[model samples]
Target: MLDHLRHLLAQDPKLAKVGLTGGLDIWLFRNSLKILEWAGSARDSYNSGNTGLIQRQAVRILDYLDGTQYVQTENIPSDIQPILVDPKIARVALLEVSQSEEPPGYLKHIGNHLREIISSPNVNDSQKKLANEINLAINNVQSWYLGVHDDAAQLIHMSPQQLHQPGTMMTLNHMFKLANNAFVGETDPATNQVKEGVSQIHYEAQRLATFDIMACSNNETSRPCV
Candidate 1:
């Protein structure tokens, strides 16, 4: 199966060189990459005198991305490949690279939740230790992410990605389902019932970690106690 995966990338040399790390490898080929590609293309459309035109182009890109979060208009992956390769567009694109910086207390909530998960006896011992580490990493990442966000807010102002990161979108979709299940029950009110779909995703996601710590836990069970 792993060899088959490698062969799939071998088909496209450009894609083959994307060099995705760990789980990120899966998101490299998704549709959101096209948005980044479009942003790079927009650089060509940038006009210092015509900010409105540039904004329109940005909006056009946003229109394509129906469910983006925060909108990362800064420091996108290099492989995303910005389009609209103009200096003005490039400048705008810089600020508008990624999401609108993660929300305040966002990581705190994540840490608290991770602590709970790790503390749960049901999660098992080794898993508990790993969860503790997960909480620590979350603590560090949230701090740095917020700091970058502050810098972006103060000194950086570029065009934001008009679409949701593919990974984020997928995670949101999953949370939406979980939220639908957890809260208000799944009742349809004509148009699938106007539920807090977006909120639900955030709510559920807060409980889950980015990395699936349980992925290989089965090995611990299957292998004999050494």
Candidate 2:
């Protein structure tokens, strides 16, 4: 079921990028491993009326799908796909599956990983299957994520903090903003008005210089602060 969804995303250009939004999206996306792990764990306990390991997992999947509307790759449930057309709705949907304090920020990392996996030169058919599964999982989260929140047409109103990501210019910009705070430049005597936002920007830039993405994220030791 999950694999089918992954293939759907891999085939569809429009729905593929939904995984980069939030934490819950990642957990449910990564639910691939858990769903499998739990099944394996339950196998030995099924004789005690546990409905068998597969049944237990199926029940769990049903609950998630029934309440959250997450479907497998093979079954492209109509309603959920349409809702996911809007990015914000998708983001909110992902946020729904995530814990408030989820670490590793799964969706963000998985999206990053997926991007690379799709482009790798040595990839084979099996790897592609896994890649697609991950993609579908991402879309499943997006499907639910987009169902009950901001749609694509709305104005985006997010803080800079939430918008943070990698890239040289972005790093430099944050650093500049962190180091510069009090709006520099000369003030006019007659008008008694301020003349600059440079100081404020500079203050932010300085602070950003010490901002270690590794220390901040903890899980990402490779991320540099500069």
- What is candidate 1's lDDT per residue for 1-226, written digit by digit as tens? 2222232222323222433222211221232233344333333333233333433444334322211332344333343333323222122211122344222122343344456666554555554665455444444333333332342222112333422223323322333333223222344567775332222323333333333433444448754344
For all predicted structures, in order, the TM-scores are 0.28, 0.23
lDDT agreement with native, every candidate: 0.34, 0.33
User: Model 2: how far is 4 from its true place, Å?
Assistant: 22
Per-residue lDDT of model 2, residues 55-77, tens digit only:
33433323332223332322322
RMSD of each: 17.5, 24.3
Off by over 4 Å in 2: 1-105, 148-226
TM-score between model 2 and native: 0.23
Model number with the top TM-score: 1
Error of 1 at 190 (Å): 60
Question: For candidate 2, what is the lDDT?
Answer: 0.33
Candidate 1 residue 89 Cα shift, in angstroms, is 25
- Enumerate clash totals for all models, in the order shown: 34, 37
